[model samples]
Target chain A: MASTVSEVAEVTRPEQVALRSSLWHEAFLRLKKKRLAMVGLVFLLVMAVVCFIGPFFSPYASGKINTAMINKPPSFSHWLGTDSLGRDILTRLMQAGRISLTVGIASMVLSVSIGALLGALAGFYRGWVDQVIMRVADVLMTIPGLPLLFIMGAVLSEWKIPTDYRIYIVMVMLSLIGWPGLARMVRSQMLTLRESEFMQAAEVLGLRDRRKLFFHLLPNLTPLLIVVATLNVGGAILSESVLSYFGLGVVPPTPTWGNMMDAANTLIDFQKRPWLWVPPGIAIFATVISINLLGDGLRDALDPKQKR
Target chain B: MNALVEIQNLSTYFKSEQGVVKAVDALELRVHEGETVCIVGESGCGKSAAAMSLMRLIPEAVGSIVSGEIWFAGRDLRKVSKEEMRKLRGNELAMIFQEPMSSLNPVLTIGEQIMEPIMEHQGLSKKAAQARAIELIELVGIPRAKEIAKSYPYELSGGMLQRIMIAIAISCNPRLLIADEPTTALDVTIQAQILDLLRKIKDEAQTAILFITHDLGVVAEMADHVVVMYAGKVVEVSPVVELFEEPKHPYTQGLLRSKPVLNQRRAKLYSIPGQVPNPTTLGESCYFHDRCDQCLDICRVKQPPLRDGGDGRKVACWLYEEESVRGQ
Candidate 1:
């Protein structure tokens, strides 16, 4: 038994000394090696810049109604064509990109923050605290998210919530439904971490429960949380798009990618006039794919067992 | 010497799916000020559990102090509130675990980890705590203390991490330090250095240490008093020299005989036969009855109580029970 322990110590000790660097530093170094992830990162950055700045450069406003230019193909004058409402599809797409990205990021932040807190509390305290939080997550997990979102949107619209406020309401709704999975992830991670020697050391040091949870356990969980949050952003964007596509998401005038796709639901538009819908569809697909790639890269990089 | 910590009839049990496991049963031990008391036993002998039970660090979800009175600083530790226990821990009492590599927080800087208990218990300012931490790091013989303080646990070697653990354990100059197989993970040379450091701490601070280990060599080198455990019960208690020269219990005899001497080469190393009894269902008879080569008829029918063998020594065995009765 003693021999086995010393053998393990001998194997682990040298590697630990050789790799005398911070976890973030090692993860960053590993992340740099994955070329596709770097490309995805660059794409996201460029997309962010385009979404934030591209509308300022457009000749036509997102709300402008140019009847003559309506349903125009991808010409130089109306690049990516105009929508059925005579709105410049490119301008509206970029403008809607801002809202979609905002909703995605906002919802991700809200859900992850809530999830991480509940998970940390439940896992660190365990017992009834674990039971209460996890059972709530279990119940929430059973509810179909899309149908719930649809119901929430219908109820909110009936209540006459204004268009701008409804976007926030949609964010809250998505976050409410999105948190259970992330919460479960954080809880399981915290459970393992709570048993780790460092955490016990912290406990033995007479550190307060709050400090141990935040300073010791939470910091160790950052890599997992970051990966979960990144992945959730793509899901959030897709969920918002689906909600809007069904006319239950961000209202028409607000021009989310989901509502924008509402224009191409007709058989004629789906087959003949692909220009009116293809750009928004491609934009959503590209954003979600890039984010997922980045998330996958992060998971690989942050895994401590991964060799250099 | 005054007893700094006294544990009487301490029995710690774990509630598992199978049954209640009596991990430590009717254990009696003490650590005196300026003395080192080593609890020696093989694996699964409950030495570590006994140490953790002293600090009440046992997992409340599964394990508990079934029956015990841990008296420390003139108070029953079992009767103390959790808040009071927290105050006592890392201040009046501190503990160092076996796996040094895993015992320190990887994300936290050494300085931050060391400075925390000082700041928390001593109520020192951050600057003062930082200074105290640096002093501690140097005290543990780590060179370039300032620079080492900024480094994380992963950046340090196992020996260095163990020293850092010592530094942290001794930060508040605790009255009693509980070391649970502290040097087991380290190599022999580093092990000696850490043991020497612990000796230095004991001499300088006059802090009582409850040293728990499986290595009898460590017990000989460090212990003033030695407690030999078997099947969760302490079979013998004697001074270091007495334990080496005259072990009384069969289990203690088996433990000493099983250890290979450096120069006495043999075809096969000596080994004690039979495994430690399953703690949950230990029978009414002597726990060592099956394993003892010299087991008598009465040994198989009844358990032996721990009886004094004079000169501050105690042993629990049917052989000693007869001797005590004859003397009476």
Candidate 2:
């Protein structure tokens, strides 16, 4: 009976607080109260900040080979221990994170741009334009996605794709395939909202069609777009990792999580050494979970159906 | 006062899956300066279509004003470029739609929506526009004008939102205001309030109003001159008093009699039997011939042109042709 009273008190307290907050503010408060999501957010933020700031303050350069402390275990001197090639796991993880996060952000931007543009146009114009765009989307969806990514990567590599230019190529390919789903969703939403009074009001106000589409219609899509992009970044990062694991993405010495895992596969001397697998595995899991949590938080925040 | 808006021989046809529907066929009407003209018709009678054509707002792909001369503010609107039409929309003339709840931008604050016209047409400063918005809100009888200006359309009540819409429409102070069924969706008391507000606003602003509605009670309350439409054509037009006292067109008389009055009680409420003829199937004969009472034999064979009644009124019926001939 006492516990039931306490539970009621717990639920009632937040509702009182929620009444005082705006939509976004209420979402942020709810997010802050969620332990797993909060932990994920903090972890992602720390990782990003460290990756940005640590490179400038490091004593050892990224390419600098330290042969003396090769394969050292966790100790006072080395917190996460050394890699097979004597490189600091802490430094390597941070450096690798920079590439992973960059690729994740880039691909998300490209995909969202394509998706939003197509979605808005398809929705606004409808009829033939809608039909043609959706048919192309259907064809793309039928193709096995991962296999297509593999084939594209291999073809690009065989054609001597530049090491510096490979990340951009991967981003483009992923974006090209990724936009259809988002576009279809946005198109349906736009169709429903197009007949709404606000659009008619904009027309009557003599706003140019372009301005109406972007300013009035586009802002309404922001929350959904944000949610989709957050979730997609995790998927894109995971896909890139898988490609790199198979030697199709990010060529040698790029310091990626996948490449680190690949190196673990070839380490013959340490049969009992789980040191090499642990760090990279943790890095991948941490990033994916962080992105997913952020996406969930955003969905809750933006959904009009959610209670304040 | 000269005619501020003259729509002569205007025909708007829409291409639908069913066939080409004549939404507005040879609609001729005029709105003189500072006059309150109301167009009354049942649903799908092309009253709204005629209004949209005046603004050149008919969607181009499926719909087109096939032939028309829309003279507005001493210029032919049909000849104007799209850019020029845009300039005319919010600057020279403004329109208030039927559903105020849907017509307002949901994301924008009431102040911003009102200020858009000021910024676009008048080029007022944000601070000045904000001040003007509050003033306009107060003019529309919204209490706490300053605070209400910060609220979104969804946050306000239905009556409050409609008032805000009127505020936006009148912000630029256009010479003409077109209201399409401004009170159709509101409750009875709210409808009265809105109609009263519109009448008061028109008197205060001295702006010529082109009001479109299906409700005869509204026409009685608001119209100075009334145009009666059937199918897609104007069946009768006269001064409000003349229309009520002696309606020449059979359709107009039928419409006036169909209403349930306060002082009269009958076995059943009068109604025009049969549905309005579909525009696609309508021939050159009188559109309302099937349902019109006192239909002459010639009514089914030939359509009647608008004939001037003895008084300052127009009736498109063969019975009024003798008066038309005598006047000529």
Candidate 3:
């Protein structure tokens, strides 16, 4: 009788002999099924390679001035034509891509790191600590981002800061202004996870607060973090371009996408000379759209509830 | 033998928009070293609140242990430092919750989760911990320990996860295990399997268990001593066989009668008459007075205290109080 019972138990049990797919692997497989996101990813990769390496092959330097070639249209000698200073627009655009992409990526990293840390601390330890951090975030969030960025940019330019240091200032300004939204998002996410049974289990297991925060809570926040960071890149790039358009970002000679479009501000230059602004304009539009598409794809892919 | 855990007058309260809720009101219980003591009660009768109060794991912001003395391992748990309490939690005492699916971290593998308490309390190296984890998995009767170890919690069935939870709880050879309805979420067949596993572990390890359940059947099967709680207070305490055969309190009798017996035909199933009193609005009189079928005038105005009945039984009812006084 006992042997038969044991045999029945054995037969009823489903075989778990095959290795199970990990969470990340499942998310990756889901992500691959998204066609638009794949296209966005490919476009971003190609843009990155073009920006980083294309400048090396170009004949004209971003700073080079040829008086005779001033305002030349697209021709055999120069692709995308020349600007008012006779500098190659293609070379300047590539250089600007490097700066714009760097600032976007660096600021995103800085803001998300600071935001996620403060948010985790506030959400996990919810009393005076939460009140203080959330109050600060609230105050920052109430201020209009563009107006604040404009004031900071005007002040830096008025101070006659060194051209080299101005890029760093712009990066810092963007990061400082960008973190509040992400902080609040992370705080809300952490608050929901704080009451989950697994977190309570971790506490019962006597794991330290640090281990619970990083190992247990942080892994659950990965999908949210990835989606937020991807979207922030596009926002950061746009902010840098707007700052440079006002002649308050990286000084004129330093070549940023924003400064490259500053020449098109005049009605005459805007209508007649399409070469000066069209390429950079199109580049900005394409990059930002691609990033947003990719962010949406990631959001859908990482959501565990979404069926493949 | 000395009690493994002695909880005296433990009261936990929660603050809410409605008012302060006395979740556990001056609850007292004890567990011997190798015995299984089951706290049986209806839902919202403070079974889980009392269990969490023992470890001081109540949410600090919303709930607080207002007064209590949880004496374990020769020290008052309330007076101990936070660090000391943490060290004692998974080492000397451990808990397994009701919902096995949500209790285990989804991202963590079974082996990693099992090794956590072992590595934390025992300070074993990763390799040694891994080996010990495999042994524990096999001990819990999992067929392919190595394969199961590599899988995440979502990949396993509820029965498998509950067994894994048991393995983790017993990893440090804890002196006491608090299982809060460990098998309630499983099917009947799986429930029987889990109960068998728990009984085997208790005999082999000699670890005292404080089992909390709402099912009388579970209490009958597993308990050495039984505590019946109603509205956050103990109504009766007795030996298991005596509790079933000769219940003293009116509430205990009601509970036993409410259970549907197998192979018995009845036109209608039996259920207790009224709902449990709301915690926040409970008055100065006995909380169960409204629901008691045989209520005296004294039972309405004054609360009955738990008094000793003969043959090691204790009951808190106005009817029993007179008999005890006459004997005294």
Candidate 4:
């Protein structure tokens, strides 16, 4: 074994590369086999591309209104139809997709960062620090999320917050509601992880607390974090729509999926003209269901205990 | 010359919900340079606790070191600063734990895990550390070193993980290696291989080993000296051959009898009746008194001190108390 090692070294290097691509590479392969998740991933990519680029190709790309053509039915000129403002609904739907997807993804990032960090700190430190962070989480959790978001949105509007900054604030609001749950989950997982033998092994290895927390601790929690973050994006989109229906999120002229549905919410449009509400409704539905499918696939794939 | 490591009158206490438990008390041990000292005891008998105390890993959260002096290489470990302790922990004094399955970070590559201490202590660059990690992996006798290093813990068997754990422990060439039941979690075949690997490391590195195990067979195989513990107190300490030839303490005697001999027939194997006493209410008496074959009246109410019985042996049974008086 010892004498042949020098000769074996050359061949071993390439094998090491194959081995290093390990868990994530394995997870990706597993995920590829799950057809529903693949479809979801493909649809989301296509939706993202169309939402970001499709509006630029439209004849009425600028959404210039024509009062005489108000609420026109579907035709070759407009694939979906014209809305109450006589803007092409297909272009508007694509435009709205951009804002909704952005809010979903941005808020997911915000919440996950805040949640995972606070939770890990609480679990690791676990004395007064745990008490303080968990109590705050508990307090936030006791109050209904919708009502609290409503109060914050009402405050944002009452303060005459500018329209351009509202999406950013709405992202912040969604994260504020989202983190408490994620933090609590992370904290509980961290508590169990702290008791794991590797932690004691880390202490013995004399790795600094900072390295232990980030490289050792946080990396282990990535599977949990990824699954939660994807799920959060879906939830964030729905919450933004709910807030938009109440005229609090990304108001008119912004073309958010929520406000588009709000535009056609009256009894006449709901009963007679099915075109307006249906497109934005389908946009929200497709984005959420795909996210859920992909998230579930990731959960199974990344799980260590998951059998083949 | 002074021994490599000397632990004097160490007492560690834990404040559990039930009450205060003396996890390790009146513990005395010495390991010379390159010597292997096997701490033999039943489960929960404070063998692991004593090993952790040497590395300053005991009394971490709910436990406290009530009293002790851990002298290592002319320095008292108990008095060192946290930074000094940390520096000493893996660089000069390293540890290998039981349960290799859970002892390694499941997410990390074996190379990354082993490279951690090499980088931290040796101040090597990442590339240098990776080369050193592969070297250490091969040094521990794992073939296809590069391939093994890149593999995750979950992919390996119990014995292989234990070998990696040993590789990590010896990466910095520590002066004293603590093995806390390192083979307890492996089957017998893997157990022998780990033992062999550890013995080879001890000889090659000239590193002292404080080996903790419940198996007499392991003690007979690896120990230069033996320290027999019962309920957190050292009952006997002797040279390996003398310990087997003329075991002194009643507890030691019972332990020897319990091992089944090869090609011998018996209706039943001898097992010491009862178990290690509960930590919370371990009274001041011979901890082995309840299960001792020849218990004196004094053994019920008065704890026997670990009396030296000449010829580099110490036994904590009242039966040997007269020998201390005669020698004194």
TM for candidate 4 is 0.91
Q: CAPRI verdict on model 1?
A: acceptable
- State the iRMSD of every prediction, in order shown: 4.1, 9.0, 3.1, 5.3
Best by lDDT: 4
* Model 4 stretches astray by more than 4 angstroms: A1-21, A32-35, A266-268, A306-308, B16-19, B59-62, B273-275, B323-328
- Model 1 Cα lDDT, one tens digit per residue, A163-259: 8898998999999888888788888888899999887887788888877888888988888899999999999999999999998889988888888
Order of quality (lDDT): 4, 3, 1, 2
Candidate 3 pairs with clashing backbones = none
- The RMSD (Cα, Å) of candidate 1 is 3.7
Relative to the true structure, how large is the alpha-carbon lDDT of every model? 0.88, 0.83, 0.89, 0.89
On DockQ, the leading prediction is 3
- 1 or 4: which has the higher lDDT? 4
Question: What are the per-residue Cα lDDT tens digits for candidate 3 across A1-308?
Answer: 65456446544443643543577887878888999998998999999999999999998964678898998899988899998988998999999999999999999998889888889989988889999999999999899998888898889978889999999889888988788888888889899998999888888888888888888887888888999999999999999999999888887899999999998998888999999999999999999999999999999999988864
- Compare candidates 1 and 4 on TM-score and give the better one: 4
| Model 2, span B23-131: residue lDDT tens | 9989888998878999999999998898888888898877999998999988999999999889888777888888888898777778888988888778899899999
How high is each candidate's TM-score? 0.90, 0.87, 0.91, 0.91
lDDT of 1 by residue, B1-328 (tens): 6588889999999998879888899999988888899999888889989988988899988899989799998999999999999988899889999999999887789999999999989999999999999999989997778778877787777888999999999999899999999999888877988999999999999999999999999999999999988888988999999889988888888889988999988998778888778777887888888889889777777778888888899999878766656343
Model 3 lDDT tens row, B139-241: 9998788878888887777888999999999999999999999999987777888889989989999999999999999998999999999988999999999
Rank the candidate models, highest TM-score first.
4, 3, 1, 2
Better of 2 and 4 by DockQ: 4
